[model samples]
Target: MTEVAKPGVLPARPHFSSGPCAKPPGYDPAKLATDVLGRSHRSKLGKARLQYSIDLMRELLNLPDTHRIGIVPGSDTGAFEMAMWTMLGARPVTTLAWESFGEGWVTDAAKQLKLDPTVIKADYGQLPDLTTVDWSNDVLFTWNGTTSGVRVPNGDWIPADREGLSFADSTSAVFAYDLPWDKIDVATFSWQKVLGGEGGHGVLILGPRAVERLETYTPAWPLPKVFRLVSKGKLAEGVFKGETINTPSMLAVEDAIFALEWGKSIGGAAGLQARSDANAAALNRIVEARSWLGHLAIDEASRSKTSVCLTVEGADEALIKKIASLLEAEHAAYDIAGYRDAPAGLRIWCGATVDVADIEALGPWLDWAYASAKVAA
Candidate 1:
C-alpha cells in the first residue's frame, strides 16, 4: 500500500457528527436573545417564543393547517414514543425498521407496548418492500435511517386514503427533504438534526388523523404525565400552542430560533434542502473518485443526504476506529464513525449547516487518514 502523504489543506470546520450537528453558519452564542432566559416557561414571553419556533417550523415545512405542530419534551425518541404509547393500541399496527432507531420502535411495539405489531424490516443498506404493507394497519417508520444512511425515495408508497395513521420518526429528514405532509399522520424530529440546533427538545407534528386518534382513542396501558397528549378525552390543545407538559431549556429554544432564522434567510425548507443536497453531492464527488470508499446505501434513490454512511474497503471495527481516531487527531474530522450497532464504516453529516467547501476539502483528509490508519494497523 502506498504511504500517502498528509493532506496540506484541511476542512475549515471538521465537525461531521450526525447529531447535535454543526450549528448554522455565522452562529454566535452571544447573539442569541437573552430576555427569555431565567423566565418561567409558562410566562407570556416564554410561551410566545416557543410558539414562534413552532410557527417557523410550520411555515418552513409548508405543513398544512390540518396538522398541529408542538414542541415535545424529549428529542425524537420522546416524541415518537409519545405517539406510539397513546395511539397505537387503538388499531392494527405495522412497524418498519431499516436502522438502529427504527429497530428501537419495533422493540417498543412488540415488548414495551405488547401491541403485537406486524414487523417489516430490511437490512442496513436497503428498504423493505413497500407494496406488501397493509394500509389498514397503523404503520411506523423512520423517514430517514440516520445510522444506515437509507431513506424512503419519496412518500409515494403511502396511499392518500389509507385507513390507518402513518407515524414517521423523521429526525434527520425534516429539513433535508420536501416531505409529503398530506401522507404523514404523525411525525417527530429533533432540533439537532438538519437544522443543527441544540438537543433535548423534540418537535411533534400531528395531522388531522393523528389528532383524531389522540382525542378518540386511549391505550389500555397507563399513560405517564409526560406521555399524555389528551386531557379529559380531548387533545390537550394548549400543548400545541406552546404550553409544554414540562419545563424546557430556554437556551435550546433560542438556539433553534437562530437556526430557523438562518434557514429562512437562505430560503426556508427549499434552501436548506438544496444546501444539504450540495453538501452530499460534494461528498459523493470524493467517494466517486476513491476506490476504497463506497456508500453503504448503494441505491442513490434511497440514499440519505444528511447522514451519509460509507463502507471502507477491507475495514473492520478496529480499522474503522483507527481511521476515526486519526481523522480526529488531525482535526480533519470529528465524530464520523458509524453508529455503534451499525456495520463498520464512516458516517458523515451533510446537513445544511455544513458547508460544501468543507466537504470537498474532506476528501484528501479522509484519504490520508485511511492510508495512515491502514499502515498503523
Candidate 2:
C-alpha cells in the first residue's frame, strides 16, 4: 500500500486520553477563578459548594431520593476499595473482571482483602457470561470495561430481588451511559473520566440498600479511617452530607462544579449521552469504511461509546505504537495508544466532553498514521 499524505484537517483538540479525558467544550481555566482555594473545606461557603456539587450530580443522574451521594478521598479506586473493605466480609462475594482496572479490583478482593472471592473473568475484548453470575453472593463488576472497550449491554441480567448487593465500578460509564440505578446498590466514579474534571476526587453513590448494609453490617477486617463510612454501628450521615472523611482539594471540587454546570447547560445527562453517542457513531463510520481497522469489542452491542478501542488488521504491538506515535508527533491525536495490558491497538476518548467534529477529524489522521506505519514496517 502507498503511504497516505498528511491530512490538512486536524482535531480542534488533540486530547483523546481515556482518563483525564478532554476538557469540557469551551472550558476556560478562568472559569475556576472563584475556587475557594485558601478557605477551609468545612467553612460555610465551602460546605455549600460541596453540597451543591453533590446535589447537581444527583440531579443530573436523576438518582432517587433514597440514594445518598458523597465525595470521598482518592479517585474511583478509593471509593471502590472503601466499599469492598466495608461491606464484603458480611457475605460471600463474586467479582467479574474483563480488563485491567476490573482485574485490579479482583486482586484487591482475593489478595489484599483475602475475601477468597469467586472471580468470573473474560479476555480483553469480551464480557463474562452475565447469565452465569451468581447473584446470591455479593457481586462486584465494572459497568464499563475501560481498557477493553466492552460494556454490559444493559442491567437486564441483574435480578431485581437478588439476595446480595451490587457494587459497580462505573468510572468510565457514568454521564455517557444510562445506568439502571435501582439495580446498582453501590456505584463509584472519578471526576476525571466522563465529566472531564480534575482528578484526585471520587464520587460515591449508595442506594438505600447499601446504606442499610453499612449501618447494620461490619466487616471482619480492620477499617482504615479513610474507608470508614459508618461510626459506632450507625451510618456516617455527615459523610453523605459533604463532610468528607479527610480534607479535599477545593480546586478540584470547583472544577467538578464547573463540569457539572457545563453538563447541565448542554441538557443534562441525556444530552451528554447523546454527545458521546454521536462522537462514537462518527468514528464508527470511518472504521466501517476502512477494511484495515475494527473495534476491539467482538459484539457490537457491547461496544463502548466512551472509550472506543480499535484493532488494526495484521498489525503487531510495535507497529501499533508506531502509528500512535506518528499521530502524536503530527499533533493529530494524543494518548490514543491502547492500554499496555490490552491487545495492541488504539483507544480513543469519545466521551461527552470531546467534540464529534474532532472525532471526525481524527479519522483521516488514523488513516494517514496506519498507512505511514505500514510503509515503515
Worst 10 residues of 2 by lDDT: 28-37
Each candidate structure's TM-score, on Cα atoms with residue i matched to residue i, is 0.99, 0.98
The residue-by-residue lDDT of candidate 1 on 1-377, one tens digit each, is 78888989998899899998998999999999999999999999999999999999999998989999989988999999999988998889999999999999999999999989999999998999989999999999999999999999999999999999999999999999999999999999999999999889889999999998888887898988999889889999999999999999999999999999999999999999999999999999999999999999999999999999999999999999999999999899999999999999999999999999899999989988899888899
Model 2 off-target regions past 4 Å? 33-35
Best-matching candidate per TM-score: 1
Check candidate 1 and list the clashing pairs.
none
Report the lDDT of model 2 for residue 290: 97
Clashing pairs in 2: none
Number of clashes recorded per candidate: 0, 0
Runs of candidate 1 with Cα error greater than 4 angstroms are none
- lDDT by residue (171-259, candidate 2, tens digit) is 99999988999999999999999999998988899999898898888788888899999878889898888799999998899899999
